[model samples]
Target: MSVLGSLTPLPAADHPELLAEPVVKALSRLPDASGVLVAEIDPDLADTAAFCEAYSSPPEFSANCVVVSGKRSGEVRYAACLVLATTRADVNGVVKRRLDVRKASFAPMDEAVELTGMEYGGITPLGLPEGWPLLIAPEVAAAEAVVVGSGIRGSKLAVPGAVLTALPGAEVVEDLARPA
Candidate 1:
């Protein structure tokens, strides 16, 4: 295995090898996933900045999945936003308007973790709630590959941009995020 940033790269793995059941199921259900290469990392370094610095990875190669929620009318709506680590999801602007809600904010950590059945720092769009749209920034979907959570803090998945766009419910949006 080789090293990527601060993580120990592993040979290409079946989703079941590195991801939780939910993630595995999601990937398997995709019409034709190109497969993901996984790397093991310290759970403590799962956050994007730390993980990138420790692994010698550039921020552009890492994508963050954030869950957002708000109410439109009387019902709550949820969405997952995927943006590069070098940028921030425009929660109050683009996202709120996209979801057609009065306001939007990051979902409470507990609710995110509980609903996704993934660790707090490892929520990926791959296994998000079925009804939630997977809102991906256009830049993120244009990258060659991006490092994302494997549904657990202990590992990461490197997936092709094409494969990411292929995920169920994924929607590529322009300027969904702003450079930080």
Candidate 2:
């Protein structure tokens, strides 16, 4: 794994305080979570661009998890998409068809935060609700190391992409993301 600038990444399992409750719980369930690492960061720089700049990690090396929702037959369905920071999830085209919904849009901030039990900018696919689909862009799923949320703004997690692919409901899709 390459150095993530000046940030110090330590074994995530040894420091539960750096992760949110949901993430910690999720990590416990993963048999291959040994490669996961965590590093402290300024909450104010949690957003992608600022984070990449501050931490000296390229956007392509970071995965941003976004929550999306759509309705079908009067029922609402939610899914999480983990795409590289350098790209954008193709919600209207590929994702809409994948979810079998008429259209898909980003979930409301409050709804996402409440349902995931994680901060708005810190939501991750690892601990999503039981049935939520986790759509991973191919690039993110194939990476050796990727920076992702630790389910909180004050810290970030460095995880092997294989661990993400091992998560429940994770699906790697072609054209899952388009250029940002």
Candidate 3:
């Protein structure tokens, strides 16, 4: 009788009080947030295609959020949220340029966890720390809906595509992502 019956368990939604502090704080800011979904899965898993297939979700529905560091300061900041299995965030171009950083690179696992308060494979744009830019690819926005991480390694959250764009501090950009 779960909201996502026979699919997966979303820890955040199931135990909202147990969520990481940053996630809790972020969710507090987004009162309209539809809520996050968690699924049970292996932590070592990295392939989005296989993950989607196992979850019975369309590959295109996955939103991949990539964290990048600042160019000059090399500070761990900014994140690009794009659709998985179809498009890759233009990290060096649109993402870097949009952040106004002279250089940018993928954020390390530890750093991603520290800043977002979520596990390496479970970070979602919905409950990210405040001020971290959440850039959405135009194509992702165009989609009718999307599936995002549920703040825990074992789940995913299905939400309206427009809802992703509506999150506080989210920026909808064109060509932010390209086919992988």
- Model 1 stretches astray by more than 4 angstroms: 1-3, 6-8, 11-17
Query: lDDT by residue for model 3 over 1-180, one digit each (tens)?
Result: 332324654434445644445556666666565445445555454356666655556676677877777655655456746655577888888878887888778888898888787877767777777687788887777766566666676555565667678877888888888878
> Which pairs of residues collide in candidate 3?
9-38, 10-38, 38-155, 39-154, 39-155, 40-154, 71-103
Candidate 2 whole-model C-alpha lDDT, 0 to 1: 0.89
Of the candidates numbered 1 and 2, which has the greater lDDT value? 2
Q: Residues 15-49, candidate 2: write the lDDT tens digits.
A: 98988888999999999678998999999998978
Cα deviation of 153 in candidate 3 (Å)? 0.3
Task: Report the C-alpha displacement of residue 153, candidate 2, in angstroms.
Answer: 0.2
> Rank order by TM-score, top first?
2, 1, 3
Q: In terms of lDDT, which candidate is strongest? A: 2
What residue runs in model 3 are displaced by over 4 Å at the alpha carbon? 1-21, 34-47, 73-77
For all predicted structures, in order, the TM-scores are 0.92, 0.97, 0.80
| Shift of residue 9 alpha carbon in model 3, Å | 7.8
What is the model-wide C-alpha lDDT for candidate 3?
0.67
TM-score (C-alpha) between model 3 and the true structure: 0.80
Best by TM-score: 2
